[model samples]
Target: MKHLTRLATAALMTTSLATFAQAGGHANWTSVADQSSIAFGSIKKDTVGEVHHFEDVIGTVSEAGELAVSIQLGSVETYIDIRNERMIEHVFRAADAKATLAGEVDMEELDALGVGETTLTDFEGVLSLGGLEADIEAELLVARLSEDRVLVTTANMIMLSTADLGIDAGIDTLMKLAKLPGITRVTPVTVRMVFEK
Candidate 1:
């Protein structure tokens, strides 16, 4: 009985250590290089555009191929303030949607991404917006900035329609003012997520 008890205790300790190693917690993002230069283009316009990068990145990682990414939502920059405000307030409803671009990536199939080299992969995760949880899947180009750091990017991709989330596109006002085509489609949003150690 004594020997059995000692063995059980040893097994428990080993399990605890493995769990700690697996759940590697969050890391700080010290710097984001080439902010104004990082070109992020939307699928709707399909033209090369620019975006402001994260001033501070935070997230966690796990051994079971889990990657939690949290980005600052208000930091988006497409070289226009009016467009930004319209998106955050009118389109995205920032008041209702306070989520700061957080999501997780499961990359068990790819094993690992190389540092400083972008590799293509597919990811599926939840995108919370305007009190809605949208399941998103897209092809992504990922590169490791450092050992515990990564950059995830997608270009010219549709981010689902506002109607898909049961939200009005506010196209009536836009069409009347700009004299442009009605908003049958929502604009594609391009994103570059950078995570640092």
Candidate 2:
């Protein structure tokens, strides 16, 4: 009976390891640079709004339900050369800077998605920007685009306060420098991320 119990224990351990490996393998995917994008919008003078693009962003979904994204703060394209320079100096405050976001996902749920299937789910993540971190919540639409590719997009816009991100001082500077009457303190952000195995 002791020997039989030992054999049963070994079998259970093996089964658990296999289940873990399969979940990790199914969740592992890397961001496709040319196909993935993250964007945010700003409002200045209370009425003029513009969308800004992050040209260099990369992310990955890892084993055991971890997702991470990093963006080069200097890669922001504001459609104006001097404005870009000003933003880098004033808002971002560093020549070499990076903003990172990390989120947790359900490994089993992600693995269960089949090709061409889509689902809307609640997402919560930490956004680290301008030397501070803030909790962000959003509704995400996750779609399995192909056997090797998955697409995730924001179903609802994420609104963030500059004060919470420690970037308000810089935006204040920009408003004064640009002689703008006012700029909105809250910004709306959205993302379209594509990942491949």
Candidate 3:
């Protein structure tokens, strides 16, 4: 009976180790960069866009299933000193919105990712931003930076008006300056994320 008990314990240990190894192979997004560009003049000059660095990004991944991402409101970036403050404190009503981005990624379908630079096909997910949730479908681009590091980038164009986010575009001249003549329909928001295993 003692020998049988020892055999069962060994088998349990092997199973536990296997599970751990599989879990460790997964990667999670630890940081995010949100940058935007604007057209100022008739010639459409491009300038160095503002960068918002978002840390405290929390998410998990499963080797065979989908990747679930949860980003905390406290972790956000707007780059501009005054703009970031106003957007979070006033426009976003950070006090109420406390926005969080959550989404799922299919690992089985994106197996070709992490092998150099790869552009993923259209991925469908829900984005909860500025106290509202919307369905989003965008192309995902990923690159394996190293044996344990990866870089992921994606661009999502939102068609909703700024008023939806409590942002009064007509209030300040600053907001008006952001407008690009002849293009008032689509707002492209891009995210570049880096992760480590």
Candidate 4:
């Protein structure tokens, strides 16, 4: 009888520990870089469009449902190294500024998501770049990949204006450097992100 009581106590302790660990795990999530991407489209001369991507991006989601993404400005890739350098030096000023986007969601809404379920929702956030910040809205497709993972993607392109972010001077510089007739002030950006607990 004494052996049976000890066994029961040990089993209960193990179960309690497991529950605590799982609870703690749900409070924080890290972005999976291998499965994520951030890209944008730029139009020049009113007809020439090019797609560019950032090669180094990172994100994190807190238990409170705050989402933050950091993009390395120097990681901008335009398929041409010279163009990349030009963008860094003139447009983004990567040497002096860091680009980041951040927002918060209702944690209860996320917690209520069932396994394998997906939802399309609106997310409002702030985009900061080149020493400027602007309020932005994005349509998001969020999916619960598993109990410990979630996938979030933009449903439509996010339109950003150089004028809005106070980057018009940078745009002018870029146009002059490229010897282009005109570069559109608006850019379209999209992102795919995966977070794991």
Candidate 5:
């Protein structure tokens, strides 16, 4: 689940966050896309569950702790190619659409964290998709892996509903097209994000 550990990290950094900017210069961390990931789980027929993920995720953090993240809806990987395509067209329903997050954290605290140290905190962020936005909060474990590298992950799994994402219609369409009798509206998500100075 190391890979899936990244799925909800998006929920971690995107929320109602403090806003500020550094005065003189901005120390920032750029997302390491290859090293980061996001994973989500879905239940169908009330019992059959599967885990899926997004292959492309990116974000940035500024000196002032401003964080912005993007998860390409088209990059969803469902293990099955046809299902992936179905999700893209029927569920996501957009070309080049992206789920984005915006919020702020305690950059000053993170800056002071020594390598090999970890901190736990709760954060709230706004996750926007399909023109709908929902407020989300996440408990996170942030570890300073190196002087210039940090690993951010969810301390607990997060729940997100299709309605919250404005994707309920798309989910309905997906079930109808596949002749699926049932699919759960709420999904559990986890995330892991890597940032480097």
Candidate 6:
């Protein structure tokens, strides 16, 4: 009976190891950069709004469920080359800016997501840009596209203030360069990210 008990214990240990490995593997994810986008809307004159997007946004999810995204400041696209250049030089100071965002999510919550199901969750993180960091709180829509793929997107617009990031002076410079009477200090941003195992 003691021998049988030892054999059962050994089998249980093997099963536990396999389960842990599978769980670890599932938590590691790589971003599909070509399929992801980060877009923002800026208002000029407190009325005219224009939508712009970044061409180079990359992200990754670690096995421990930490998510980090790096956005190329110089990749800002405003549908016009001249405007894009202006934004990079004046507003973002692309040459010296480090734009990164990071956050953590419960891996267990993600692991419980079933294929074809969507879950709404709160994502809390920090957005670091132009030598300043601000706490970020946004709603996220997480969809399990497949066993090896997942999609995460902003469920609502996140508003950011230029003053909060010490970029208000840059906005003033842009306003002057463009001869605009006024430019709103707040911008709305969103992200659509796709990750695969």
Top lDDT hit = 5
Q: Please identify model 1 stretches exceeding 4 Å from their true place.
A: 1-85, 94-97, 100-104, 107-118, 177-179
Predictions in order: lDDT: 0.38, 0.61, 0.37, 0.60, 0.65, 0.59
- Cα displacement (angstroms), candidate 6, residue 126, comes to 1.3
Error of 1 at 92 (Å): 3.2
TM-score versus the correct structure, for each prediction: 0.55, 0.84, 0.53, 0.83, 0.87, 0.83
lDDT of 1 by residue, 136-163 (tens): 5556555565565555555335345545
Per-residue alpha-carbon lDDT of model 4 for 139-190, expressed as tens digits? Answer: 6677777787767766776666667767677778878887989977767776
Q: For each candidate, how many residue pairs have backbone atoms clashing (under 3 Å)?
A: 0, 0, 0, 0, 18, 0
Give a tens-digit lDDT track for model 6, residues 1-197: 11111111111221121222223355556667787666777677767877777676666666666666666666666788877677778777664344676766665655576778877776666666656676666676777777777777767766665666667777777788889998776667666766676
Please report how far candidate 5 places residue 90 from its true position, in Å: 1.5
Worst 10 residues of 3 by lDDT: 35-44
lDDT of 3: 0.37
Model 5, which residues run further than 4 Å from truth? Answer: 1-26
Global CA lDDT computed for model 4? 0.60
Model 3, residue 29: what's the lDDT? 30
Q: Lowest summed-lDDT stretch of 10 residues in model 6?
A: 1-10
Measured by TM-score, how close is model 6 to the native structure?
0.83
* Candidate rank order under lDDT: 5, 2, 4, 6, 1, 3
- lDDT of model 3 at residue 148? 53
Clash pairs of candidate 2? Answer: none
* Tens-digit lDDT track of model 2 for 1-197: 11111111111221222222223355566777797666677777677878777777766665655666667777778799888888888888775777776766655755676878877766666766655676766666777777777777767666666667677678778878889888777667666767776
